[model samples]
Target: MPTEAAFSWPREFVWGVSTSSYQIEGAVAEDGRAPSIWDTRCRMAGKIANGDSGDVACDHYHRYPQDVALMRELGIGAYRFSVAWPRVLPRGRGQVNEKGLDFYDRLIDAVLAAGIEPWLCLYHWDLPQALDDLGGWTNRDCAGWYADYAALIARRFGDRVQRWATFNEFSVFTLFGYAIDWSAPGVTDRDAHLRAIHHVNLAHGLGVGVLRDLLPQASIGAIHNRQVVWPEQDCDADRAAAALLDEHWNRAFPDPQLLGHYPPQIAAAIEPYVRGGDMATICRRLDWFGLNHYGPIFAKADPQCTWNFAWGEAPADAPRSALGWPTWPAAFRDELIDLSRRYRLPIYVTENGAGGSDSVGADGAVDDPARVAYLRDYTGALREALQAGADVRGYFVWSLLDNFEWGSGYGPRFGLVHVDYTTQQRTPKTSFGWYRAFIRDARG
Candidate 1:
């Protein structure tokens, strides 16, 4: 593999890291914050690995200043973080929590003081438990509720935050939470899944409009988790399964939001829920496309599953990450080129990193050669995509710290900085130094 010096990055290309609220901020019950659906899922037996929860993941709610300082030390140009909807709106709507809003104000101030730009993401799957009780995203009114929440965030943080993302990975939560019994407020019904899809898209469009109106100067976009879907076998059923999964996974959110209509397979089913001018309401102009690509996903037919498809395994000979995900940098390169051509918008690789089981060494240092190699190969592919006319503008690593990963819990560490869960001590990994140097060289 070529070294970092071999590739050239674009001028003004962004270099940063990202983290979500529930994954890191662990003041679950403090400051008048209410329960998100994930909070409720944590209490359910057998739902999460080791029965773990985000109750105190990274303790970032109380330790954000230290985290911000770490970003400055790494010379990161931008910091992408999400606001816990339940934290700001205790019931997900009506009655704002000043304390919750105040915490973010302090965080934003600290981030700016460190000379880093703040990119605020409106939602990161932490829907207030109160809202879930009222039908969650399945209900049509959920879109209005999300827009209201966006309005609150805009009015409070808009002055400081110029880059805003409406939602992070819209299809991931809706699919796992509604169609599969894998995530919070778990349900496995088709109608419920369709409703959630349309409602979330509607919410995103409405949120975009709100941000544009309230924060006219803000550069707004929505983050999507897109990946190539492949069949597990050569059989027709498996091929059919993969096709539908592709529509749901790759095109579901971006299609309606970008092209103003649902994909063919989803259009008929979702039409019932989409009222007059709902597509017009759900499609809004934006500044960029946030693409979160990890690795390609494999799907197989499953009669038992609600969607008639189940997650399949990658090829036996494929290179695998420590967490069992297939690691193929060519796919990353192709995805950027394809997304640029398909969307015709500036692309930002918002989340891309490898997860591993990392631990402090006998010498009190964390050595993660796999992560270092992964970053090198992936970033190299990013360069190839850019050179191929991908319209790529930026790339932000999946995370800065190993926080609570949903379902899999905290076992899979994706952080460039190692976090000692017991002591909350952050030790920069070998990849941390590598990324810092890569950023400096990329800028020059």
Candidate 2:
């Protein structure tokens, strides 16, 4: 490992950007695409901010060529994107949608033609409504359904798309969707949350097995968002609260995947709710682990808080993003280093970016220096972690363009390129130029 003073990425380091289908693809009902849970949820009253939806998000489904051109111009080596399940299996199981498969056929070809590798994520919370109506992630059978879908995608596009992520942020989807009722197919029952979590874990393992069987040479993995839970005070009570927070947020899903066992604390907490063999199903081995990190959580012992711990209100003097997340780069480095040591898997910064309110200036350019600073500082943190012996192989910025941000809608922009929703125009922000320059320097 390089020491702190001599830290730098390998010459072939992968520089990439990531985006999801439901967040960017749009054309929800076109080309034989069917409704996803997200589509159904956004139509519900008051479910999303400004009553906004991703019905026509950036028209990436129609304009991917231009997007690929942008990636090529930015000197990026890879593009991490998700495929919509409903797009491929319109009703989520029985029949395959040729049109849906064709769309991705073009997409993968476009990325390769641009000399960029396509990293495909099989699921990104856009489950087909047909599946959710029957049972969704809460149903064990959904695991088999997901595996079938994964098999189809791998057989169809595996030759071109060498990197595959089985699921994107399973904890977020399970907790927010079931426990908090803030995301799609919203349910607010703890039992449902526990069930969903189990099914998602099983799906990951089953999906990986399918991908490996079908695309034997492909690199298969999952993207899980891991956060550092720090106590507000060093007291025993505070430390205990922090431990619980960590079990729920960071270790719950990964522990099972990497170690084949749930955290003892989490298992005890949910013991009354768990059924037999659920833990074993979640302990699937993975080829790689994608770490989607943003900021740290400072928790305090609080019985009143939903999860038995509370995140103190945004600090009075700290800088925050449009999403109100603290701007802290140190957390990024620490989290990566810790995860690298604990998991012992090749790591990828699958997602990291701040949400900001950006607009095209009168000069026809977006001067997002704040975003530039965020990227620079965060990249420096990544370098620091590498110096400390983290086996990080790549960094994929959170987004390439501003698209739907789930419950928050499009209100918060987390893109290097600004998207004018009404006009569907893409304008590269100053941060985009900075990233391009960084990639050039890293390559040099």
**TM-score of each prediction:** 0.98, 0.95
lDDT of each: 0.93, 0.87
lDDT of 2 by residue, 49-79 (tens): 9999989988999999988998998889999
Residue-level lDDT tens digits of model 1 in 9-128: 777999999999999999899999999999999999999999999999999999998999899999999999999999989999999999999999999999999999999999999999
Each candidate's number of clashing pairs is: 0, 0
The best candidate by TM-score is: 1
Cα RMSD, each candidate: 1.6, 2.0
Q: Tell me model 2's lDDT, rounded to 2 decimals.
A: 0.87
lDDT comparing candidate 1 with the true structure: 0.93
